[model samples]
Target: MNKLNNYKDNEYEYYPICINGQIFNCFSSMSLKDLLLYLNFNLSLVIVEYNKQIIDKEDWSNICLNINDSVEVITITGGG
Candidate 1:
């Protein structure tokens, strides 16, 4: 596993990842769960696709994100 400190840019390090086809920069190493929280997602109401695979909710905390990794998040909404 690569440490968060592995990347540096004039005193800052950023990990670039793709979420829902958009690029985002994140600092420090974090799990999918953390990412969801950072994005203000309600865990119980969302589904996550990691690297083109549907990820089990139980595995969110164990899946560490990598640079350039692709993720897709879908929020479940109620409709009449």
Candidate 2:
């Protein structure tokens, strides 16, 4: 058995989430749904807007992340 092997899971790591102009690193190996859950956010209300469009849950996992990807996850919240 070879101890050294390449795996897609190993490629995943914690990265910064750029919102507006700020950077924040939180979770890793998590899909958009997972991320929202971790943040105690409402997935249905929030929008994972990236690359000039909203990314559906089905497409979130397939959304390949790169080093320093200019992404901003906007959550639509209400206030009074």
Candidate 3:
């Protein structure tokens, strides 16, 4: 992996990813689970779509993010 070191000596790889029509820099080494956590998403209340395909919650930790990848986060809401 192409890693970048910051001034603090922290190594990371950032990739441009599109989420819900917005472009954001994402850690290339993070899994969907880590990404969700980093974004402060409530795992129990959201449905995640990766690359246009809905991903199962059980598989979130196994999917690695990539460059130019797309993600959609749909929040579940209940109301009258």
Which tens-of-lDDT digit does each residue in 49-72 have in candidate 2? Answer: 664677886776676543344455
Rate residue 46 of model 2 by lDDT.
Answer: 67
- CA RMSD for every model? 4.8, 8.7, 5.0
The runs of at least 3 residues in candidate 2 whose Cα sits more than 4 Å from the true structure, single-residue gaps closed, are: 1-13, 76-80
Pick by TM-score: which candidate is best? 3
Per-residue lDDT over 10-74 for candidate 1, one digit per residue giving the tens place of the 0 to 100 score: 86677878889887777657799999999999999999999999999999999988887888999
Score each candidate by Cα lDDT: 0.84, 0.56, 0.83
Candidate 3's error at 70, in angstroms?
A: 0.3
Clashing residue pairs in candidate 3 are: none
- Give me the displacement of residue 6 in model 2, in angstroms: 19
| TM-score of model number 1 | 0.83
Query: By lDDT, highest first, what's the ranking?
Result: 1, 3, 2
TM-score of each: 0.83, 0.52, 0.84
Instruction: Give candidate 2's root-mean-square deviation (CA, Å).
Output: 8.7
